[model samples]
Target: MEQDVFRLHYEATQARVEEALREQIGRMGRYADLREAMEYSLMAGGKRIRPVLVLESCRMCGGDPETALPFACAVEMIHTYSLIHDDLPAMDDDELRRGRPTNHMVYGEATAILAGDGLLTAAFQALTQADLTAQQRVDAVACLSLAAGPEGMVGGQAMDMAGEGRSLTRSELEQLQSLKTGALIAAAAELGCIAAGGSPEQREAVRRYAQCLGRAFQVQDDILDVTSTDEELGKPTGSDREKEKNTFVSLLGLERSRELVEELTAQAVAALDGFSSRDFLVWLANTLAQRTK
Candidate 1:
């Protein structure tokens, strides 16, 4: 019965995210050919996990999904920007994403770079445009900026680049993954609390939950990169091995990585114990840990 409720919620959230993506993208006007490229890449399929996190966290905090929609859209824009930049020639240099040609491959390197920049800027613009109180807007901006800026996602990306082709300690690898993958996820949940005018204690609880879930999500992603097929993953597998990047599976072996994912997922779910209305978040954390791709 619990599983059924979770599945229903997940499906509903997925549909909502899909609808939001289409509506948001439709609002992007054609300034030039670049706009087309941006839309093409933005509409490329993803699991919409981050946006759903935003909505679920907001709802758990007694906020309306409608009130959280802008923040949800903002986080997705940031995530899309990261994917665009990650696939550039100077980065991962992937030719495919979400089972289609990557942004750079389809739109040229320069245009893809510009598209990433556009999405990054647009993310903050969307957050600022949210229909919320002045304080809520301020909190949202601060949380998101920290997540996307040098101290968070960008810093993690730099660390990842630096760590490539080099062995790292378990602590070092975990730290890098936490920043690169977890920061924005944590920010998304925190943004939800902020949007709802949640208390500091409630916000902290959400942040802790997101931090653990982010780690679990990234570890599962690394595991899938090794075990899942491209069709199952909607993207190429074995890219981590190809790139010679440090991942949990590489550092800890597959069995140990799987164990760590379970551990982290449990910790993530545990963090929600203080919240009375965290059914959706608890389900999300467990689902992320158990996801096939």
Candidate 2:
């Protein structure tokens, strides 16, 4: 029953984010092909976890979730752009995503790259267009830039690429995942706080929650790669092993990795200790800890 309620909330949030994404894309006028390519991947079905975090965090901070919608859409756009680039032949070389052909596979490589570029730039445009106070907009944009810039997500990707075919210590692997995957997620939570006019303390607490959640998310992904099927994952399973990447499961063994996920989930929920109206966020953390995809 609890799981059903969580799923209902999840689906509702996903629908809201999807609708806003379509509306945001509809605002673009030039480069019809580029728009199509961008939409190809942007509209690809997946859990809109980051945007949901934005909304939920806003609500947790006693703000209207609707006020955060535009920024939420921007976060999703940034995330989708990352996915588009990560699937390029020069990156992970993936041909499928979200159970369909990847952007590059459907639109060709060059266009796909541009599509990613368009999404990334348009994210800031969306931010500018949002109905937000100047301070809120500035804070949100700064949070995103810091997270997505070279020292954050891009840096993490570089580390991941460099670590390929090499042994990495557990800390090294954690750092890599924190930068590559956790950064944007942390940004999502922080942007939510900014959109809500949260104070420094509130933002700091939520950031900690999101950081733990993000790490747990990657740990779950590592576990899924070893345990899930291609059909379930919507991409080839065991690719981590095939690519010779060091993962939590590889380093800690499956049982210990599962334990780590649980511990991280607990830590994430604990970070919400003093906040009220955090039930949804707590459930979200737990659900993500056990996500199958």
Candidate 3:
């Protein structure tokens, strides 16, 4: 029953984010193909976890979740753009995403790159046009830039590429995942706190929560790639092993990776020690830890 309620809330949040994303894309004019490509990837179905974090964090911090809709949409856009690029031939070279052809696979590689660019720029555009205080917009943009920029996800990708075919220590692996996956997620939670006018201390607490949650998410992904079938993952599994990438499972073995996930989830939940209305976030962490098998 509790799981059902969490799913209901999660679905409701996902629906709200999708609606706003559609409305945001509708504002773009001309460049039919670009728009189509952008819409294709942007509308691709997923859990909308980042945007949900934004909304839920806002609510938990005593703000109107509705007012955070634009920021939430922007966060989702950034996340989608990253996924599109990550699937390109130059990156993970994936042909499928979210149970369908990847943007590059369908639209060709060049257009897929442009589509990613379009979504990235559109994220900032949405932020600039959102009904937010100037400071809020600035804070949100700064937060996202750090997460998505050279020192964050992109940097982590560079590190991952460099470290390929070579074994990595557990700390190195953790650092890579923190940047590659945890940065944007931490930004999502912090952006929510920013939207809610949360205190610096409160925002920092949520950031810690998101950072641990993000690391747990990647560890879980690593485990799933080894344990789950492609049909269950909606994309090719074992790509991690095929690519010889350093992962939690590769570094610490499957059982230890599972233990790490449990530890990370507990840390994430404990970070919200003082926040009211945090049961959903705690449940969300547990759900990710137990995503499959």
True-structure lDDT of candidate 1: 0.87
TM-scores for all candidates?
0.96, 0.98, 0.97
Could you tell me the lDDT of residue 291 within candidate 2?
Answer: 81
Candidate order by decreasing lDDT: 2, 3, 1
lDDT by residue (119-212, candidate 1, tens digit) is 8887887887888997898889899989988999988999998888999899999889878989999999998888888889889999999999
- Candidate with top lDDT is 2
Deviating ranges (above 4 Å) for candidate 2 = none
Root-mean-square deviation of every model: 1.3, 1.0, 1.2
Task: Supply the global lDDT for candidate 3.
Answer: 0.90
Q: Tell me the whole-model lDDT of each prediction, alpha carbons only.
A: 0.87, 0.91, 0.90
lDDT of model 1, residue 235: 80
Clashing pairs in 3: none
Which parts of model 3 are misplaced by more than 4 Å? none
- Candidate 3 has what TM-score? 0.97
- Tens-digit per-residue lDDT, 91-112, candidate 2: 9998888789999998898999
Model 2's C-alpha root-mean-square deviation from the true structure amounts to 1.0
